[model samples]
Target: MNILVMMKVTFSTEEEITIEQGEIVQEGISLILNPYDEYALEQAVQVKEVYGGEVTVLSVGPKRYEDTLRTALAMGADRMVLIDDPALMGDEWIVSQAISAFAKKERFDLIFGGQMSIDYASAQMGPRVAVELGIPIVTTILEFTMDGQCAVVHRDMDGYMEKLRVPLPALFTTQQGLNEPRYPTLQNRMRARKKPIVYYIGEDLDFSHEDRQVKTVSQEFFVAPRRSEGKILHGSLADQVKELCDFLRFAIQ
Candidate 1:
């Protein structure tokens, strides 16, 4: 089996984040693998362990994203690929395009990814890639098992659950209840640093920045306004209602 895991590098919320000049400042910011993506990687590694196959982790991001790829390698992905193309970095759709291009380059029997990245939480990349490849996709999968060339999947639907039997060469976006992610061991870390990561740029993939422009643009970045303390009214029921009405009228005025 040839399995592919789509992963992402995200800023660690443990560290303070600051916006400057209409952009997020990278300085003093800590980066790590997206937590949800880690679950996908763990499931891929588990599949490779049970079945005889190679697992490859891939990402579309800047050069610094290699760090997160290395971390994935340490977690048990057999190989890593990074598309460090600044021009191609636009929106979730552009990233999905680049990933679809890479998928076309290499044939994969199964593709796994997180339901959404922590940064954007759009949850569109996996579905977009599946559409571009014309393959079936199942999102928010909680459990997955292989039988021959087909997959037995269990996923959450709103508050209920659904089971499916999807064929091979399909994409799946993992949810939190899928599985627990394992930490890299000391030995794995040593070997991961020595692993070579395949790198590519936008031109190599025949992707033009102008054609891959982001449809949604961020106008500005500002913290959510702080919430004010709640006001309490104490008196007889009628008196409390009258006081609330008075307060509302005064505020509206």
Candidate 2:
């Protein structure tokens, strides 16, 4: 089995985040592997351990993302690939295209990734990549088991569990109940430092100028405005009801 895990670096949720001029301030924020992606990486490593194969971690981000890839290496991935290029940076569509192009360069029996990154929470990358690769995909999977050349997975459908049997060369996006991610041991951490990361730029892949263009024309981020304090209605029940009615009428107007 050759497992491929799609990973991402994201701002740590524990860190204090602030928006300035409609953008996130990233001067001194902590960056780590996307929390949801950890489960996907752990599951891939465990699959490699049981099936006697190699786990490769892949990501498309800036150079600072190398740290997150090294962390995945320490977690038991055999190889790392980073698609780093300023021109390739865009919306999820462009990132998925880059990842799919990389996936085409290698053969993988299974692909694992988080259901969504914590920051954007768009939950579109994995599925988009799957579509680009023309492969079957199971999203928000809670359980996965291999049988012969197929995989049986359990996914959460609202409050119910839906079981599915998918063939090999499929992609899976993991949900929280998948498994606990293990921390890298000191020995593995040391070994990870020695592992080399393979990098790819826009020129390395076949992309036209149109493909490199940003699909999204504009994006804005702003902190939500503070909510006004609630008003208290005093006096008798009828008085309170009258005040509430008046307030509602005024608000509607």
Candidate 3:
């Protein structure tokens, strides 16, 4: 099994977000692997361990993202690919195009990624890549098992579990409950520091001008206003209901 895990570097959720002049302040914020992508990478490594194959991690971001890629390698991936190109960086549409281009050149039996990136939360990268590759895809999968050349997966569908059997050469986006990620050992971390990471520039990929065009015009960031304290109603049930209605009406007005 040749598995490719798509990963991303995102802002750490533990840090506080600050906006200055409609832009996020990134001077002192920490960056880590996308939380959801950790599950995808863990699943890929486990599959490789059981089936005896290689796992490769792929990401598209600036050179700073190499640190996150190194962490993925320590976790169990064999190698990494970093597509570091300013022209190729854009919205999800353009990023997916770049990923699909690279994936099209390589052969992978299975492609895995998170249900959504923590930063964007668009939930479009995996499916978009699958669409570009003309492969089958199942999102938000909680459980996955191999059945010969097919894969059986369990997903939540409107509070009900839906079982699916997909053929090989497909894509799957992992959800939160898929599996717990493993920590890297001291030996693996040492080995990861020596692993090779291939870099790709925009000129190397096959992309037209239209494909590189960014669809998003502008984005703004602002802090949410503090919520007001709740008010208590001291009276009978009818009076409380009347007071609540009146309060709501006044607020709306």
Candidate 4:
């Protein structure tokens, strides 16, 4: 089983992120692997433990992202790939296009991703990548297993727990409930420090800055969305209830 774990670099906060000339500002901020993707990688490590295979951590980002991928290697991935290219900054679909293109070349057996990235929280990248590759995919999965030549995925739909079995060579977007991610032990970190990384770049990969070019650009960079002040209505319970009701009625009216 050749497992490809797709991860991403994302900011830690939910707000209007500062962009210096269309690129994310990173002066004093820390960039971490999307937590959901961390869970996906941890799960991939576990799968390798059971199935006897290699875990290849893949991320499409700038050259600086190698540090994060090295961290993933420290955690336990057998190998890593960084699809470093400036044009990947276009849009999510472009990033997906680049990854799916790379995946096609590898003939990997399984692809995994987190339910969503922290910053966007749109939960679109994984499915989009799968679409680009024309592979079957299941999202928001809580757990999964190999059953013969199929994958049995468990997920929560509404309030009910549901299980679906799909064939191999599929994509899965893992939810936080999947499994607790493993913290890299000292020994693992030491080993990861020396692991060789295979860098994937623009020259060899067959992808263009064209094709659904989002034409997306930011006008300016800002901080967290401005918040409004809340007024507190304080008084006796009965009086407060009446006041709140009066305020609502007045506002609505």
Candidate 5:
């Protein structure tokens, strides 16, 4: 089996949010493999253990993202493919296109990724890549089972469970409850440092001009205004009601 795991590197959870020039400043901030994507990596590793196959992790980010890919390799993934180029950064559509382009050159029985990137939470990449590959997609999978070329998946829709069966060469976006991600051991971490990481630039992929463009543009970003403390109503119920009514009237005005 050939499994490909799509992952993202994002700011560490403890990092403070800092905005600059209408964009989040990442300089000097600690980055790690996206927590949600870790689940996909864990699942891929588990699948590889059971089926005895190669697992490859793919990511689109700067060279720093190699740390994230290394961590995945330490967790038991076989190889890493990195599309490292700042010019390739765009919205979900563009990212998925690049992934699809590279993926078309290789054969994969399964592709996995997080349900949504923690940074954007657009929940579009997996579906978009599925469209580009003309394959079926199962999002937010809670239970996964495979038998030969067929996969049985169970997902949560609202509060109900939905079961589905899809053929090989399918894509899946993992949700939080799917599995517990394993931490990379020190031994594996050291070994991963020696693993080779294949790199590619934007020009390497065949993408149209429109596919490379970012669809959404941010106008501005500012911290939300501080909220005022609640006022204490000290008096009889009638008096308090009267004060509340007056406050409401003033607020509406």
Candidate 6:
């Protein structure tokens, strides 16, 4: 019942973001584990309670991300695998490739991740990795259970329910509606404080390609305008449908 959870550590909203030479200037910014990844981590921990096997937390990012994985360890994953490869920094395809390659090497029976990383909302990374491994990918899984070598999962697709069963060694990237993640208990937090945080460097992994070819570079990074905080579209089911249909009709016309 070995499971692997992929996580990302990101900058908090309170931290100021800047851009220098096209790359995000995150120096001195406070970093935290991706909120969405916490849901995946929570689910994996719950499964650990029943199945009873090692839960390995893995992440591919800059050297600074070790602080983030330590946080996941505090939450209760059994082991950690850090792919310290410089080439993987901020490149989604390479990150997915290197991670999937590493995960396959570990022979984990199940791999779970968040729907997408917060810093980059490209939701295709998980599925893309699964494709690289030639495995089935069930995304947006709200609920799932392991039965022998099979997995029964509940998925939501545009207000419709989708029940699916896939073979073992599959990939799942989930949304937040799946379950509520619990906070680290006092004792666990204390233990986590004493836990060892291992550091790995770029030369550790087998790196074949380093795409140094750059087509363009950015000069700055700025936040987008936040939409209205409230103003529900419509509360009633009928009103919601009417609003949606009217919007669609207007859009088509």
Best model number under TM-score: 3
Runs off by more than 4 Å, candidate 2 = 229-253
Candidate 4 ranges beyond 4 A from true positions: 14-24, 208-212, 215-226
Q: TM-score, each model?
A: 0.91, 0.90, 0.93, 0.90, 0.91, 0.80
The window of 10 residues in a row where model 6 has the poorest summed lDDT is 209-218
Which pairs clash in model 3? none
The better candidate by lDDT, 1 or 4, is 1
**What is the per-residue lDDT of model 4 for residues 1-253, given as tens digits with 9 covering 90 to 100?**
8999998987666544566666667756777888899989988888899988899998888777776677788777899888777766556777787788789888878899998988767788888988888889999899889998789999999999999999988999998889998887888777887887777765557766564365455565555567898879898999999999999999999
- In the range 33-52, model 1's lDDT, one tens digit per residue, is 98989999999999999997
Sort by lDDT, top down from the best: 3, 2, 1, 5, 4, 6
Residue by residue across 92-181, what tens digits does model 3's lDDT show? 888999999999888999999999988779999999999999999999999999999999999999999999999989999998999999
Error (Å) of candidate 2 at residue 197 is 1.2
- Overlapping backbone residue pairs in candidate 5 total 0
lDDT of 6 by residue, 113-167 (tens): 9998787787867888899888899998999888789999999989999999999
Model 1 / residue 37 / CA error / Å: 0.5
The CA lDDT of each predicted structure is: 0.89, 0.90, 0.91, 0.82, 0.89, 0.79
Best by lDDT: 3
Q: How do the residues 1-253 of candidate 2 rate in per-residue lDDT, one tens digit apiece?
A: 9999999898888997898887889768889999889999999998888988999999888888887679999988999989899877778888888888888888999999999999989999999999989999999999999999999999989899999999989999998989999999989999999999999998788877777876774368887788999999999999999999999999999
Error of 4 at 202 (Å): 2.3
**Candidate 3: regions farther than 4 A off:** 233-245
Q: Which model, 1 or 4, shows the larger TM-score?
A: 1
Q: Which stretches of candidate 1 lie over 4 Å from their true place?
A: 208-211, 232-253
Query: Compared to the true structure, candidate 6 yields what TM-score?
Result: 0.80
Clashing pairs in 1: none
